[model samples]
Each structure stands twice: as structure tokens, then as C-alpha cells.
Target chain A: MRRITILGLTVLVTAAVLVAAPLLGLETIDPRQVAGGAGAGPEARIFWSLRVPRVMLGFLAGAALSVGGLTFQALFRNALATPYTLGVSSGAALGATLAIRLGAAFSLLGIPAVSLAAFAGALLAVALVYGLARARQGCSANIMLLAGVAVNFSFASLILLVHYTSDAAASFNILRWLMGRLDTVGPDEALRLLPLVAVGGFVALALHRELNLMSVDEELAVSRGVDVDRYRVILFVTTSVMVGGVVAACGPIGFVGMMVPHVCRLLIGPDHRWLGPMSLLAGGAFLVACDVLARLLAAPAELPVGVLTSLLGGPFFLWLLVGRRGAACSA
Target chain B: MDANRTLTPVLDLRHLRLELDGRSILDDVSLAVREGEHLAIVGPNGAGKTCLLKCVNRILRGWRGMISVNGVSIAAFSQRELGRLVAYVPQVGGRLTPFTARETVLMARYPHLTPFAAPGLRDQRYAEDALALTGIGALADRSLDTLSGGERQKVYLAAALAQDARLLLLDEPATFLDPRHRDDFRRVLRTVNRRKGVTVVEVTHDLNCAVLDADRIFALKDGRAAFCGPPEQFMVREVMHRVFDRAFLTVNHPTTGQPVILPEVGGP
Candidate 1:
């Protein structure tokens, strides 16, 4: 009951923050003034075109990645598992890099070329992992993780090769994107990606019970009338869309997917019905708060939100590992 | 007793063959378990006992031949349908998270639940009743991770009971428990079979325990049924020697009049 209450309060707090962010008198210029045709001032354009979209994108990306992380972790039944652990992010990065190298225009369909490439790359990576793992009888969690690591390493090398060959300007842009900055996102881009994220998130939510059973024991899950292979395919594909979509919009934001779910699991019990959705909401709030801190701490020039999340998540993860080990050792 | 009245078999396996890695594991194994009957499968290690159990639950899908439950081919049934009919409990071990005992049992109802729908009050009531029946209602709120080996085994049994399956397949349910707990586990199984009429097929290495409760005993040798009959048949020295490949002295229990086999000194 306490945990439920905490989750409820957290949801309310996050909703309030998301709603009141724009309305707060943080800056002198009123967004209403700029909208009322008051000379089309720079501040109003920045508010509408820049900060609002960036905030929205941060929330969307954070929620998507975190939920993807929860799904992957449960599906694999590995504590160290994440969506990118399978090389999806690296694959997406490589695809985006190749697209940029081919001179594809970002404004072609109101969707960035890089994001499109990333999505395609992520799907391909998932296919590759599934294909390799399925070849040996059935796709067990251990085999999938091993396959993912192999694919990730291979793709990382390709990404590095691309990075070396690219020109200075392209390299700089790629480097910044890889660090995961939400500064360049516009409101239109967030609107474009929201539907895909929401749909994928909902599909994931629906499979929570099956995923929980899968986490316990795959063979047991099969006996329980769950089509284990089919559910695995659905879960992997859905996570691909969520993670691939986010990686495309913003470069691989490390640890959001990894840390958020683990933290949520510790706070709430291992019930996926609550764990999966709460991870998304908490992850979104966490990123927004981190983004706000990144902006305020380095006003005029912002720190990459990914950097802050990693800085926070890395230490917390190590602490959890030590604590878990201590508990196991003592027990 | 009406000896002419044939009891309907709840589980039947005919001409069953299992091949793994180009090696035959189970070959032409045939068995029939009557409704509400308690059957025990005994075999030496690596005798394909586990493989046979897996085949019954469709965990090993590549097996050949006929396996039917309630007169329907198991292959024709969907996974959900199979789950509703059969509940499988495997040997328990490995990393387990801390789920409350009630929550753990509630997972058994997953097959009955639709995607995105929560369990109704009826489901909860059933779960509660199952917990009470298993005699673990007091431990319902405790974390599974904190339970002792014996307690954990009971919890799993409760979960299987909550599934409300017609046939229960257990692989070595008594392997990790002490003698007392093992007896308790068998008592629960006997009660469930008697009251709920749930057919039980369990794989066990304990020959003594198998004799104590099994209505029918099937002794497997190299993946084939070497002996299938009453416990008294297993005590015959010649039968034991042929299947177990050892010399044994058969003696009658002074009080119970049951044949008991004791390993004889000197030769096979």
C-alpha cells in the first residue's frame, strides 16, 4: 500500500511538473506576448520552437527507452540487460551515419533522416539477434544476450569506422548527437514521434503478465499456455520501435534504460504490470529533471542530459551491485 | 469393487519416441494413467524420466507419436487449452525474486486471464481457497525468497493447485525436502487426488516413497518401460535383477505382508 501510494504521488508530481513547466515565470518574456504578434520576438520563438519541443522530446525519449529497458530485462531475465545491450543503438547509429553520408535530407518528410535510418538499423539488429539465437533449438535468455553482445561489438566497430571517415563538421555534429542532447529537437518532431512511442508503450503494457511469466522460467511459461516464441517476437519488435525511435530522435542516451527499471524494481516489487508503466513515467520525469539541471547548471551552454544521467546512474548501479553482493554473501 | 468397469484414462501415451541430437531418448514408450490415479515414474539418472515429463507438457515439441489428454490429441490443443488441462511443476532452484506467496500462486491463473485484464474477485477467491487448501494460508503474505526449501516446495504445490488443472505433472517434487516434508508433500498430493480428482504423474528416484503412495508404478530402463505393475512386482528378485542388473534378496514384511527387496552380497 505504501509503495502504491508512493507511485501515485510520483505520478501526480510528474504530471504537475510536465504541465506547469511552460507556465512558470522562469523567464521574463511571456509566451502569450510572442504569440499575440508582438513583433514576433526572439524569446517567444525560442520558447515555442526550441524549449517546448526539447522538453517534450526529452520526456518521450526517456519514457520509450526506459520502458524498452524494462521489457528487455524481463525478457532476458538478466539484471545487466538493456535494449542497447543487443547492439540496437550502435546499429541505429551506423544506419543514421550511412544515411547522412549519402546526403539524405533531414527535412524530407518532416522526420529527420538520421531518425529514419536509426529505426531501420534497430529493426535489422533485432532480426539479426533473433535469427542467430533461434538457430540453436530455441532462443534462451543466455543465448540471446550472447548474440546481442556479439552484434553490438560488430556494429560498434562499424560505427567507429564511419566516425573516422566523416569530415570535421559532420564528425562534430555526430559527436554531439551521440552524447544525446535534446537542444535541437523541435515541437513538430516530438508530435511526429509521439504516436509511435505511445502505441509501442501500450503494446508493451499489454504483455506485462506474459513477460513476468517469461522472466520466471521460459519452459514454465510455455507450459502455462503462453506462446513463448511469439511473445518474444512481439516483445523484441515492440522494444525495437520504442528504443529505435528514441535513438533516432536523440542519440543513444546511456543508462536511462538500464538504471530506471532497476530503480523502479527496487522501489516496487517485481510485478511487471506496475513495474513496466511506472518505469516509463519515472524515466520521463527523471530525464526532464536532469535536462532542467543540465540547462540551469551551465546556463548559456547546456550540458548533455546523457552525461548527467550516466554520472548519476553509474554510481547508483555500482552501489546496487555492491549491496546485492553483500546481501548474497551474508545470506 | 467392480473389476469389469474400466476406469477412463486421463493421460495416455502410445508409441512415443523422442530423439535428441541424433540419439533416441524415449523409444516406443507406452503408458496409461487412470483418472484421479496417483502414478509414479521411477528410473535411474539419465533414464529419460525428465524428457518424458517434458513431452507430456509439450516442452519438448519434437517428440513423435501419440499423446492424448481426455481423448484429444495433445497436438491439436492450443497452448492455453493445454495449460488449462495440465500443470507442470519442475525441480525448483536458482535465483528467485521476492514475491509474496499469494502473488506467486496468483500467477498460476495467467492462462485463464486475458491480456491487459486484471484478475476478477472470483479469481482472487479461488486463489485464496487454493492457498487454504494447501495449508499455507498463514504464509501467504511472506516473501517466497524467505521461505525454507520445504515451505517453498509447498508454495509451488499451492500454485499448481491454484492452476486447477486436471492433470498435474511433477518432476521430483520431493528431491529437495526432508523425509517429513516429503511425506507431507505426498499426503497433499493424495488429498488433492482424492478430493479434486486431479490425476498426478510424478517422476521420482525414491523407490520406497513410490511404493508407499503409487497406485501404479512404471520403472523406466534406458528410456523404455522395463516394469509396469504393482509395487509387489518390483520386489521380485528376478525382475529387480533384470531391470536393475543386480542380485537382490526378496523378503516378505512380517507385519504388512508386502514384499521387500534387499541387495544381496557378492554378485550381479
Candidate 2:
């Protein structure tokens, strides 16, 4: 009953935000004009084409990041773990840098060349991490985590190398992309991301029970009949696809995945059934609201949503770490 | 002997050898447990008692020899199939977990539930029944992190019981229990073994508890069974002294006539 109430409240908030988000952007959107009557003017175009897609993109990217973050955290059994923590973002950055360096101008199947390149890069990083971890007997969480850290550092240097070789304009583009941005996505990009996030979210919800068991104890999970190794691989692959999609769409928005799941867990107990969907809804709402604040706070200037989120999430993460010493030690 | 004596043994392990990092963790050990029999294994800290239990459950796989469950080779059974046939209770030392006692117990139904299906009413009922059997039904809603050590141990036992498996492999089940809870655990074990006809293989450090509970006793020394027989046979002072490397005094229970042993304080 309490879980239902929490879920209901979260859905209500998400719905409210979804309706109100388009109204808060720089241009005033007349709802009557958007409702489609005579004299609709420029409001209809701005509402439909610009604000709606941007907000949709924000929600989609946030949901994907949070869901992927939750999955990775549960798999690794570490709260500090996130989709971006293991070089996915850096990989995407590298891919985007390559695209900029090559002067790529063509879009592939509706997705921009840069996003396509970023997605490919994210998948490559996941493959590299998975391969390195699997090469050692079992893909133990510790080994995978260490491998991810190593990949992250190597990818960072590779990004720097790409910057060194590329011209000044390409280097600036790469650095801006690395800071993470959530605006400027089109309806086509949002459409491309929707199906992937939907499938990934569905799979995650379906396996939430297994995640619950695995999080507590991996050996115990196996003894209770979870195909631990098989499930781990499935989860890793699923999270990679989801993270890749999000990064490709929004230049690797930071902290949504790491922050949202932990917040949702605190709200509803760690039952992933509740945590999974709740985190997604809360995450989408969170990013949209943050984007709104970023717009309002700077007015014409507009702070990057990623920058605002990181500013908030970094401290919350520290508080979480410091407040729960026991979890910190064990996790 | 009963009519079921003609049936296959519930558990059969033959020449099982496990080498970890080139060290012989288990060396050519063989044993069999009959249907519904309660067997207790007692040994020192490094006597491979836990390792042997792990072998039976296939948790630590890649053993050199064969393990059969009810006349079927373990290799033939999938992990889920084996899980339905056997439940394991590991020795957890009051670790804080994010699951409620009921939720933890319901996890036993994982092997029974189809992948992507939530636990149905039937599973919840069975979990509740197990909690009742362990006398922890009232505490089922409590988080495992908040439960007392004894209560937590009972929750683990309840979870194992909820599996409803034919065989149970317990490692130091009473390690965290107080005297009353220990008795409660023994009673629960008796109910499961006798009433439900479940086979049990328990690793315990408490010799007295074993004598009071188990139908048969298996003593291990350095990964090898030093003694395997009825509790009466295990009560022999010379065999007890030899297995534990200490002198022991034997006493029969006043009411049940079961043999109990106590190690002498000054024994070499």
C-alpha cells in the first residue's frame, strides 16, 4: 500500500512536469494556440518542434541514465558505481571528437553522425571492459570494476590524444561535449532513443527480483537458482545499450543515473520492482526540473543541465557515502 | 530399517577431490546419507566442513569425482533443478542487507518461479508457512538489518525451509543463536526432518547439539572423515579424543538417553 502510494505520487509528479515543462522555456507557449485553433501563430511551432522535443529528450536521457545506473550499481554491488563511472561517457566523448575531427556532415538513419559515433564508441568501451573482465576466469564484479577503471583512464588519455592531434575547433567541441549537454536534440533523435530506453527499462523491471537477490549476496543468489553468470552478462549488455543510447542522445549527461536510483531507494525501500520504475520516473522529472532551473537561473545565458546536476549530485553522493559508513564498508 | 531403506540414498558422494590453488581442500572424501536422515558433521576450524557442504550444493564446482542426488548424477541437474532438490543455509554473521525477512525467505521460491514472473500467492503462503515453522512469523516484516542475531539466524533457517527442498545443507546454523533460540532451532530441525521427511546434512561445532539432534554423526579431520557412524559409536572416548586431538568425557542425556561429549579443559 505504501509502495503504491509512492508509485502513484511519482507518476503524478512526472505527469505534472511533463505537462508543465514546455511552458517554462524561454519563449512563452500559449496553450490555447497549442490546442490548435485559428491564429496559432509561432507558439504552435515553438511548442511542438523546439520545447516539446527538448523536454522529451531530457526525460528520455534522464530515465535511461538512471535505469542504467541502477542496473550497474546492483550488478557491481557498489553505490558509487554509475553508467558514466566506467568510461562510457569518455568513450562517447572520444567518438564525438572523432566525428568532429573527420568533419562528418552526414546523418545516419535520422541520428546525427556524432551521436552514431558516440553510440558506437560507448558499445566498444563496454565490449572492451567485458572482454578484459571475462578473460580472467569468472567476470567477478571486482575484476570488472577494476577493468572499467583502467578503461576509463586509458579512454581519458585517448581523448586527450585525439584533442592533441585534432585542430583547435574540434578540440573545443570535444571539451564542450565532455562537460555534458542536454539541449539541442531533435524529434528524430528523441524517437530513436525512445525504443531503446523502453526495452531496457522493461528488461530491468522484469529482472528487478533477481537484482534484489543479487544485491544482497551473489553466492546466495546462485544457491537459490539464479544463473548468476548468465544474468550478469545480460544485465551488463542491457545497461551498455541503454547508457550508449543516452550518451549518444545527450553528450553523456552526468549524475542522473547515480543520484536518482539512490534517491529512489531511500524513498521506496530497495525492492527493485519499486526502485526501478520509480527511479526512472523520478529521474526524468528531476532532469526536466533541473533544466528548467538552469534556464531560469541564468535567463538568456542558460547553465548546462549537466553542470547543475553534477554540482548537486557530487555533494549528495558524498553525504550518502559519509552518512552510511556501514554500507560504505560492505558495499 | 524402514520400507524406504530399499530406495536409493538421498545423497551420494564418491571419491570427491577438490584442489584449490594447488592445495588439497578436500582429499578423496566419500560419504552417503539416506533419505530423511539427519547427519551432523563436526570438525575443527579448518577441517573442510564448509567446503564439503559447498561441494554438495555445487557452489564450489569442478570437483574430480561424482555427486548424486537421489540416484541422479549432479551433472545431469541444472542449477535450478539442483536448487529445488537441495537448499543451503550459509553461516552469515549478522550482515546488514536491504531485504525484509519475508522478502529474504520468499527468495527461496526463485527456482520454482519462472523467469520474469513475480512470486505468486502460493509462493508467499509457503514462505509464510516456513516463517511460522521457524517461529519467526511475527518478525517476517522486519528488515534483516534490524533483526537480532538469533532472529536473523532463524530467518536464514526459515528461508532454507521455505525452499521446500528434499535435502538441506546447513553450515554452522546455530552459530549466532542464544540458548533458547538454539533449542528452537533444534525443534524446527526435528519438525522438518521427522514430520516433513527432509534429509539434513548439518555442519556444527557444537558436539552436544549434534548428539541431541542428529541421527548419525560424521567427524572430519584435515578434510577427511575420521569417524562415520551412529552417535553411540561417536561417543567412544578414544575415537572422540583422536578426531579432535583432545580428551573428552561422554555423558548420556537424562531423559532421551542420547550420548553427549565434553572436551576436558586440561587435555593435550
Considering every candidate listed, which one attains the maximal DockQ?
1
lDDT tens per residue, model 1, B45-64? 78889999999888888999
Query: What tens-digit string does per-residue lDDT give for candidate 2 at B58-156?
Result: 778778888999989988988888889999888958457877899999988888998788899999999999999999989988888888888998998
* Residue pairs whose backbone atoms clash in candidate 1: none
Model 2 ranges with Cα > 4 A deviation: A37-40, A101-107, A164-166, A323-331, B246-259, B265-267
Model 2 chain A: weakest 10-residue lDDT segment is A322-331
Cα displacement (angstroms), candidate 1, residue B151, comes to 1.5
Chain B TM-score in each of the candidates: 0.91, 0.95
lDDT for B48 (candidate 2): 88
**Alpha-carbon interface RMSD for all candidates, in angstroms:** 2.9, 2.0
Estimate, for each residue in A1-331, the C-alpha lDDT of model 1 and write its tens digit: 6777868977997797676554332354565666744247777666667767777988888898888888888788787788899877887888887776666775557777777887789878878987898898677788988999999999888877888888887787677767877766457768877987898788788888887788777887887878887888888887887788788888888899988888887777788888877898988888887888777777767788888889998988888788865222211
Q: Name the top lDDT candidate.
A: 2
Q: What docking grade applies to model 2?
A: medium
C-alpha RMSD of each candidate structure in angstroms: 2.9, 2.7
Question: Chain A TM-score for model 2, please?
Answer: 0.94
Off by over 4 Å in 1: A20-43, A101-103, A325-331, B1-7, B246-268
Tell me what TM-score chain B of candidate 1 gets against the true chain B: 0.91
